[model samples]
Target: MLFKREFKRNLRSLIIWSIIIAGIILLYLSIFPSMAKEQANMDNLMNAVPSGMQKAFGMDRLSLGTLLGFYGIEIHLMTTLLGSIFAALLASGIVAKEQNEKTAEFLLALPISRQTIIAQKGAAVAANVALFNLVIVAASLIGFQFSSAQTLSYKAFFLLELAVFMMHLTFAAVAFLFSAVARRTRSIVSMSLGLVFIMYFLSVVAGISDKLSWLKYVSPFKYADAAQILTEQSFRPLYAVVMAVVIIGCFFAAYGYYRNKDIVV
Candidate 1:
C-alpha cells in the first residue's frame, strides 16, 4: 500500500519531467549538429582553443566533427547533469515525503511487513529510473536519425548512457538512504544534491591529478566516464558490480533502520 501510493505520486511527477526533458533533448539535437558542422571542417578549432578550456572541458581527444566525440565531450554533460538532478529529486522525496505529510504512522498501521515495504519502494524507484532511461535511449535514436555529415552508431552512445544510467541508480540509492534517516525533507533534498555534485567534482579532480587518482573509485562518476565509454566501448564492470552491491546494501540498511524506529504522531 505504501509503495503503491508513493508510485502513484511519483508517476504523476514524472509526467512534468518527461515534458521538460523532451524539450531539452530536442534543443540539444537541434543546435549541436549545426555547430558540429563548422567545427569539423575547421582544422584550427583545436589549435585556437585555449589549453585551460581544453582541460576544463576535457576536449583534448575529441573532435567536434565526430558525433561520438562531440556528444560525449560536449553535449552529454547537460544530459548527465539533468539526469542526476532528476534522480536526486525523486530519491530524496520518496521516503521523506511520508514523514513530511504525517503519513508514516498511518502507513505503519497497515498490515504490510516492513521488508515488503522496502522492497516495493525500491521497485518503485527502480521503475522510475528505467522509464527515464527509456526516454534517453529514445531521444538518442531519434536525434541520430536527423543528423547528416555525421557517421554515428546509436548502439555505442546508448551503451555510454547505460553506464550513466547505472550511476544514476546508485545516486538514487544514496538519496533514498539519506531520506530514510533524515529529520526533514529540505535537508534530505539538499544533501542529496550535494552528494551528487561532490562525487562528480571528486571524479574531475581525480582525472586531473595523479596523486588523487584513487578517489575516482569512491565516486559513481568513475563508472560513467563519457570519454571511456564512447572511445573504448567499455565501462568498468567491476565498478558496476560494486555499485550494485552498494545500492542493495543501502536499501537493506534503510529497511533495518525503518523497522526498528517508532514513528512519531
Candidate 2:
C-alpha cells in the first residue's frame, strides 16, 4: 500500500518538484564560485545598492567573499520564496488531491484506519521535503568546495538548512489544516496560497512600517531569517522550536478534522 501510494505521489508533482529543485541546486552550485568571487566587493556593492533594494533585500551586512556568506545574501529571499511555496503547495494539495481527483472513496475503502491513511500521506509529504533539502545540501557542499576558505562548514550549513526545513514543514502543516477543514478543494488551495502570501506581505510591510513592526513576528519568515544564518551561522532556536510545535499541533488538528469530515465523493 505504501509502495503504491508513495510511488504514485513520487511520479506526480512531488518527483517533478524534486527534479526541479535538483536542477536548481546543480545550476546554482555550478556558478556559485564565480558568483562568490564577484560579490567580494562589499564597499562597491553596498554603496551602489539602491536604497529601495537595500530596504527590500536587507543588504546591510552582506559581504561578498565566502561562498556561504555570498550566497546567503544573494539567495536568502530565494530560499524564503521557494521554501514557503513548497509548503503552501504541498499542504494545499495533500488532502485536497484525494477530493479533487475523486479518489477519496477509493482511498478510504482500503483496510487501513483513517489515522493510518493520514499518517501515510503525511510521511509522503515529509519525504518530498527531505529530498528537496538533501539536494540543497549537496549543492551547498559543491559550493563549499570552491570557497576561499577552501573548506566546508558542514554543521553550520546543515543547521541553517534545517531551519529552512522546519519552516517548510510548518507551512505544510498549516496548509494541510486548511485543506482538511475547507469545504472545497480549490478553496483550500486558494486559501493556502493566500495564507502564505499574507504572512510574506506582513513581513515586508513590517520592514517598511515601524507601526507594524509586530507583523514580523506573524510571519514564519521572521522565525527563519536568512541574514541571521549567513552572519551568525544559526537562527533563533526559540522560533524554530515554536514553529515545529505549531506544525505538529496543526497536523494532528488536520487529522482529527478530516477524520470527522463528511465528503460527497
Best TM-score goes to which candidate? 1
Residues 108-187, model 2: lDDT tens digits: 88888878877777777777767666766675566455444545465667777888888788888888788777757788
| Candidate 1 clashes between residue pairs 3 or more apart in a chain or in different chains | none
- Candidate 1 Cα deviation (angstroms), residue 41: 6.6
lDDT at position 230, candidate 1: 73
Against the hidden true structure, what lDDT does model 1 obtain?
0.76
TM-score of each: 0.90, 0.87
RMSD of each: 2.1, 2.5
Candidate 1, 80-159: lDDT as tens digits: 77787788889887876778899877877789887777678878888888788778778766776567667876667877
**Runs off by more than 4 Å, candidate 2:** 2-4, 36-42, 50-56, 148-152
Alpha-carbon local distance difference test for all models: 0.76, 0.71
Clashes of each: 0, 0
